[model samples]
Target: MQRGKKKIKEWKLKDEDTRRQFEVKVQQKNNRNRGGWKQLSENVLEAAKEVCGESTGHRRRRRETWWWNEAVQRSLQEKKRAYKRWQRTQNEEYKREYKEKTRQAKREVARAKRLALENWSEELNSSEKQKEMFRIAKQMKRESKDVMGAKYIKDERGVIKINTEEILGRYVTLKTC
Candidate 1:
């Protein structure tokens, strides 16, 4: 069975022509297949693919915004409401209110972020939180690294290391040096 069976665009089946095409394809394949369940299953999958498109499985990466809180949400909502009101009326008073709300929202978000970072730093300072500290450090490192950049590990000759063995050798050589 194909891994992305669920990824098939089922909405295409809503169209009558598409449904007819799928049914015809399945019927044509069925007449040729004398084999049991396996052949029928394969024919159905092939029909589905030809009728509806499949997703490539690539998805967008969502960033972790751990600092977001209730205050930020409320401020952002107020800003959005003000902005809509200003857009609807084009009045100077409403525009000014929208600007003020935008600024307030920004301030709240910044404050929340600062507080979160401070809390993380405090946790890192505590001996008991060593495991949590390392986990956070690893997550931060993973987030900060450029996906398209070359590997950071280098040999003693200053050549960038690529392979796992070479990278390990570079680390071992560094410890000795």
Candidate 2:
């Protein structure tokens, strides 16, 4: 037996209708095998050129050259310099305002403290009892001494040292006249 089926004979068209049908089938097959629109357009153009003729001088122009202008660059530099100057002025103004605000606050606090001391002095001097109480409080502070981690009474030549414990405790003593 022949190794391969002896190269199958090519089909020959016998009529115009058969030839037209064969061409239609080939075109459909070609369309199915084609890619997207760009590829299809390229294939169609190539086929058109084969059937018709090719055109010339259909090329795109080169793009224009671009460079930075000296004047524009200088203007940009000036704008940046002006911005820095304005920023410096604004920062100085902010610092000045902050200092003035802090100075005002300090002045208010000093005035309030002075007025409070004046009122307290007036209250302390208003009544004789208040004055006596203040004197007694001062005397008590001068005489008190810590003894054995507690305040106690001590006598020196009949002078009594009275503290919290001695003042609060009750005592009884007998005397003959």
Candidate 3:
């Protein structure tokens, strides 16, 4: 169970000692008081936490921004410093500097993204990267199928035929045609 998203623990049921300790704690709770289902469940969870350990329930994720280099980092840092200076002093010059820095950082980030995409496209055009391109295409196709689920017939005005009678009428017209 999650509590404030700070810690998450699961029962170490595979370990014999953990299982025994959990059982003992649960039994002690059950004997100490005759409580409602909520109390009982809370006790069980407490016992499990004592036996098990907490986890953030996070896995390693791939970084999408492969083109994030030192230049982009420096630009962002400069922008942040300018913004902080402006915030602290509330000076017009500082504010202008912050705005300029923000624009420069945004341009840098956009340029990096464009360059990375171009490089990736170039690599994909090479014969050796054909397999990679096909793999990406297949993955995109699979994702599209998952997103665009259950295609339905639409009328000429582009409204979906929701009623059974309307669907049957459309089917009849199609068969006749």
Candidate 4:
């Protein structure tokens, strides 16, 4: 279908004739299986594929966690191995090593993710296009759902007013209240 229009191309051959020819071709290909495939329409075929979540790519379902890269995966695998070794041996040395490795792996992953975020933030801050910064800010707002607002209360005059009094809470939490 072409853009800016809603026109379906007419089939050169009729649907019934096309299905009959397709059936004959299938029958010829598979001599043993006399019962050929059922008539397939474009709509039905697309619907089936949609329902089945069909994809040609072998890695179509690969986990798409961007922050979890090869380095993090390697570290995690190493940590797992260390944990297993410690579990099997029950040695103090192995246990200490495993704990150290686990901590290091966690720290490395955190540093990498933090660095990535900082790099992105820096790039957005330095970008000439204002739209990019706004977009990033919008995305951050969406991902960080922490509400920010001062608590409002009805005054003696029966008017809702923002409470400016000091509250026994963290700044972020106070604002949220």
TM of each candidate vs. truth:
0.44, 0.24, 0.46, 0.39
| Candidate 3 local lDDT, residue 122 | 85
Candidate 2 clash pair list? none
Per-residue CA lDDT of model 3 for 37-155, tens digit only, reads 99899888877777775555445433335688788999999999999999999999999999999999999999998998898788787786788788889999898874556556777
What do the candidate models score in CA lDDT, each in turn?
Answer: 0.85, 0.50, 0.80, 0.61
- Can you write out model 2's per-residue Cα lDDT over 3-107, one digit (the tens) per residue? 332221122233346456555654654677678777766664444444333333234433221222344445445555555665678677655555555555555
Residue 120 lDDT in candidate 1: 71
Which 10 consecutive positions of candidate 1 have the poorest summed lDDT?
1-10
Would you list the rank order by lDDT, best first? Answer: 1, 3, 4, 2
Q: Which wins on lDDT, candidate 1 or candidate 4? A: 1
Which segments of model 3 are wrong by more than 4 Å? Answer: 1-64, 147-177
Residue 67 displacement in candidate 2 (angstroms): 72
**Evaluated with TM-score, which candidate comes out highest?**
3
Error of 3 at 104 (Å): 0.5
lDDT of 1 by residue, 71-134 (tens): 9999999999999999999999999999999999999999999999898778776686688778
Candidate 4 lDDT over 11-86, as tens digits, reads 3123456556545654444554343244334443433333333333443334434366678888888999999999
Clashes of each: 0, 0, 0, 0
